[model samples]
Target chain A: MSVPVCVLGLGLIGGSLMRAARAAGRSVYGYNRSGGPVAAAQADGYDVSSDLGAVLSRAQAEGALLVVAVPMPAVNTVLQAIATTARDCPLTDVVSVKGPVADLVRDHGLDGRYVGGHPMAGTAESGWAAGFAELFRGATWVVSADEGRDPVVWAEVARLALDCGAAVVPAESQEHDDAAARISHLPHLFAETLALSGVRGGNLTLALAAGSFRDGTRVAGTSPALVDAMCEANAAALLRVLDEALETLAAARTALAAGSTSELTESGFAAHQKYLERGGRPSITGIVPGDHEWLARLRDAGRRGEALLTLPREVS
Target chain B: MSVPVCVLGLGLIGGSLMRAARAAGRSVYGYNRSGGPVAAAQADGYDVSSDLGAVLSRAQAEGALLVVAVPMPAVNTVLQAIATTARDCPLTDVVSVKGPVADLVRDHGLDGRYVGGHPMAGTAESGWAAGFAELFRGATWVVSADEGRDPVVWAEVARLALDCGAAVVPAESQEHDDAAARISHLPHLFAETLALSGVRGGNLTLALAAGSFRDGTRVAGTSPALVDAMCEANAAALLRVLDEALETLAAARTALAAGSTSELTESGFAAHQKYLERGGRPSITGIVPGDHEWLARLRDAGRRGEALLTLPREVS
Candidate 1:
C-alpha cells in the first residue's frame, strides 16, 4: 500500500511536494498556518488544513510521510508542534541549509523519524502561486539521513523525492550542509556583492548594464532572511569557501593590476575548464545506463546552464 | 557616388561585415595579411583580397564601406597598411575596445576617413569559421566618430550597422571605454574571480559545487588574450569597477558578520524585486529593431526574461 504524504508550510517547496505526491499516486495532505495557501490548495482539489490537529489527523489516518518544507528558522516551531501531536509516522524536511535544522531536530530528539532533504533547484520566485508539479524533475534532491534515522523513514523519503521526479541524492547531514555552502550559499554572497557594487555606480552606467550583471547576480535576489539563515546555519563551511573566493579575487586583481591580458585570460579560462573537467555526480545515475550517459547529461546541463548563467545568446 | 569602402582586416569581424553588407544590398570588399580569412571570404562568394594592391583596386573599384576587424595589437599595423593603400574610402573598425585604436588613428593622421566602430557581441569561439553572417544582428554597434571623421562617412557607417541589423549607438571614445568597462569588461573580472575562488576549494568541497558556482563564473571560459586586451585597454574603468565591487562585497561581508540579515535580505530582495518589477526587456531590442516586426518577438523575449528574473516558481 502506498504511504500517504503530508506537506507542511505550503510555500513554494511545500506546495510542490503536495502536487507532485498526488501526481505520483499518493494520498496528499497540506498544512499551512495561514488559510490563504490552504484555501488555494483546497480549491485546487488538495486535502489541506490550517489547523494543526486536523493536519495531524489526516496524516495519521492516511499513514502519511510528513514533509517539513518550512523555512529554516521555522523548522523548530513546526517540530515542536509535531512533538505535541505525538504523530509517530516517518518525517522529512526540505530546508536548504540543513546543519542547524538537523541540530535543532537532534536537540528536540526527532532524529528517528526525520530525514533532511534538499532539492538542488529553485528560482527567485516563491509562494503557493509559484508551485509547479515538475519543479524537481531531473533535479538533485539531496536526502541527508544520519545514522539515527530509521531505514524505513529513509526509504520512504527517498521514494518521495523519486516520485516527485527528482533524483534521490543521498548524503550525510554535514556533507549536505558543506556541499550546499560551496555551491549554493557562497554564490549568494558573490552575487549580493556584485550587485551591491553597482548600486554606487552612475545612473547611466547602471542603466546601460547588460546580461552579465543580471546573470552573475541572479542569486542576490533571493530572500535575505532565508539567505541569512542559510549562511548562519552553514557558517563554518561558507566562510571557508568565501576565503577561497576572496583569495582568487585577490590573485585576479593582482593579475589585472599587472596588465597581462593573456595571463589573466588563461587563468580565468583554466579555472572554468577545470570546473567542466571535474563535474557533478548527478542525483539520478540509474535513470540511464553507463557513465557516458551521465557525462552527456552533465554536458547538456552545462551547455543549457551557460544560457542561464550568462547571456541568453550572443547578439546574432 | 558613395565613397569607397576599404575594410583593412579580413578576420572574423571584417569577414562578417563583408558577408552581412553584401546580404543587406551593399557592395563589400575585404583585405587580410594572411591569405586565410580573405581566401575563405573569397571562397564564400564575397569580394576579398590578400594582395594590398588588389584590395586597393577593389576599394577604388566598388567604393564600399571599410571595416577593420583585428586584434588590439594588430590595429596599428592595419592603420599603417591603410596609410600605404592611400585609398579615399570611408573606414571603420570592429575592434572590441576603441580608445587606443581611435587614438592610434588620430596619432597616425588616419582619422579623416576613419571612424571607430565596435560591434558589442561575439562568442568565446572565434576565427573565420566562427564568423556567422548574422553575428551582429540585434547587437549594439557603437560608432565613435570624432571631429576629424567626415559627416558623410559617419552616415555611411551608421547605414552599415543598420544593414547588419545592429543599433547604431553613438559615444565618445572615453565614454565608450568606460561603458564597456562596466558592462562588458567588469563582468569578466567578476566571473573569473568567482571561478578561480570556486576551483581552489578542497576536493570534497569542489565535488559539492552546483548551479550557482557554474552560473556566476560562466564568462571565465572565454579566450584569455581577448580578456587580457579588454582589461588592459579599459584598465582605468575596469579598476574603478573592481574597486567598487570589492567595496560592495566588503559591506555585504560586514553585514553578514554582524548578523544583519535584514539589511542583506532587504538589499538582495530589493534587487530581485526590481528586476521583476521592470518587466522584461526584449533580447533582440537593440540588435534587430526597425528591420523586423519585433512586437511579438519583443513580447516573447520580455516574457522569458521576466520568467528568468522574476520569482522562483514552486515545484511540487
Candidate 2:
C-alpha cells in the first residue's frame, strides 16, 4: 500500500494538500490548532483534530510521511514537536520559502529526513472551506535536492508531488529561494507600489484604472501580514532582484526625463516575447531521484523548463 | 435621422467603433489605408474604402460627425485631412492619448469643432475580424471639456460616446493626460521592465514563474512601437509618476536590504482595498454638457468616482 500522509496545519495550503492527497487515493489526514477548521475537516470524513501531539504520535506509529504545512511564523513551533516525536519520518514542507525552513529543520537536527518543498499554488482565501482537491493540479512543486539528501526520502517527496498532480522541480534550497525572489516576491513589491500610486492619482485616475491596473495590482489585495512574512523570510535573495528591477525603471525614467523614449522598451519587449514562447515547450529528458548524478540532471532539466511529468521516470 | 458617423483608419479601435456605432442604430461607415482590411470590412457589409479624401468630402456634405480612429503615428495625417476636407464637421478621436491629439487638432486649426474623446476599450487583436458591435458596451469614454469649448459640439461628442454604450467622463485635456500617465503609461514601463527581469534571472527562474509573473507581464505583450509612442507623447506627466514609483521601490529595496519588511506593504494594501471599494460606486448627479458650470461639476463628480450614467441629463 502507498504510505499515508499527515498534514500539520489545516489552513488553505494544508487543508488543500489533505484533500488533494486523499483524491489521489492515498490515506491522508490532518491537524488544526483551532476547533472550527478541525470540525470542518472532520465533517468531510477525514481524520483531523486540534491535537498536535496525538497526530505526530499516530504518524510515527503508522510510519506516515509528515508534511509541515503552516505559515512562516508557525513553522518553528511545529518543527519543535517533530524533533521529539516523528524525527525519522520522511519529511517535507509546503512553505513559500525553502531556505528558512531548511534552517529551522537543521536547527532541530531533522535535516537528515528533511527535503524542502514549495508548491506553486494558493489563493487569498483561508481555512477548510477555501481548499479543494485540485489546488496543485498542473502546478510546479519545487523540491530541494541539496547535497547529501537521502535518495529514498527525495523520491518519496517527488512521488507525492507527482501524485498530487504537480510536476516536481528539483532545486537546491538557496536556488529555489533566489528564483522565487525573482518570479514571486519581487512582483509583490511592484504590485504594492503600483496600487498605492494609482490611489494617489486621485479619483479620476482611479476611475480610469481598468484591466491593467486591476491585474497589475491584484496581488496587492493579499493580506499585508502574509506578504510581509513571505518577503521577510526571503529578504536576501529578494534584495538582489529588487535592485535589478529598480535600475531598469530608473534608466527608463532618465531617458524619459531627457528628450528620448525609454531605452529599455525594445529589448524589454523582446524578452517579453521570449517568455511567451517558453510556455509548454518542454526540454527535460528521462531523469528522476535516486539515479546516478540525478541532482545535476534535474537541475539541467529545470534550466530547460522541464518538470517531472515531461518524461517518464522509475519511481520504484 | 441621426448624424452619420465617419471613421478613419479601420484598425482595431476604428473597426470596432464602426461596428458598435452601427449597432446602436447610427448611420456609420469607415475608411482604411489598405485594400485588405477595406475589403474585409466591405465584405462584412460595412461601408468602408481606401479613399480618405472622398469619405471626408462626403462627411462634410452630409453634416456627419467625423471620428478619427488611428494609432499614435497616424493621428497627424488624419488630422491634416480633417483640416482641409471636413473642417466644419463635429470632430473627435479615439487615440490612446488626449493632449497630443489636442495639440495636433489645434495645429490643423480644427479646434473650434473638435472635442477630444477617448473610449476606454480595446484588445491586443487588430483588423476587421477582431472587432464586434459589443466592444464598447458599458465602457467609460473620456471627453475633454476644455475652456471655451463649444457646448453644441461637446454635447454631440458626448452623444456619440453615449450611443456607443460608454459613459462620458468629462475631463480637461491635461487632466486626462495626467491621470492616464499614472494609471496606464507608468504601468507599461513597469511591465516591460518586469518581463525582462524575469527572463534575466535565467531559465530556471523563468520556468518557475507563475500567475503573478503572467499577469504582471501581460501588457508587455503589446506592440513595442505602440508602447513607445504612447510613452513618448506623454513624457512630461509620465516622468512625474515614474519618479513616485521609483522612490517607492527604492525605499522598499533599502528596507529589505537592511533586514526589514517593506515599509510600503501596509499602506499599499490599504490603498488596494480602497481601489476595490471605489469600483461601481457612483456620485455624479444632474451634470451634462451645456449646463452651467458643467465641467467643474463633472470634475467634482469624477473625484467622487462618478460617471455620466449615474444620473439623468437632457441631451437635446
For model 1, what is the alpha-carbon lDDT of residue B4?
45
Query: What's the DockQ of model 1?
Result: 0.23
Candidate 2 achieves a global lDDT of: 0.85
User: Which window of ten consecutive residues has the lowest lDDT sum in model 1 chain A?
Assistant: A307-316
- TM-score of B-chain for each predicted structure, in order: 0.80, 0.94
Expressed as tens digits, the lDDT of each residue in B205-282 for candidate 1 is 455566788788888887777788878877777777777767666665666566654665567567655543544232
RMSD of each: 10.6, 2.9
Q: Write the per-residue lDDT of candidate 1 for residues A104-204, one digit (tens) a residue.
A: 87777777677778877776678898898998887777666455555567667767887888765556676667667766777787677666555444332
lDDT of 2 by residue, B9-30 (tens): 8888888889888888999987
Q: Which stretches of candidate 1 lie over 4 Å from their true place?
A: A57-64, A145-148, A192-214, A217-235, A261-264, A274-316, B53-66, B84-90, B111-113, B145-152, B196-214, B261-316
lDDT of 2 by residue, A19-39 (tens): 999999999877888899999
Give the residue spans of candidate 2 off by over 4 A.
Answer: A25-30, A49-54, A57-63, A258-263, A281-288, A310-315, B42-53, B281-285, B310-315
TM-score of 1: 0.80
Candidate 2 matches the true fold with a TM-score of 0.91
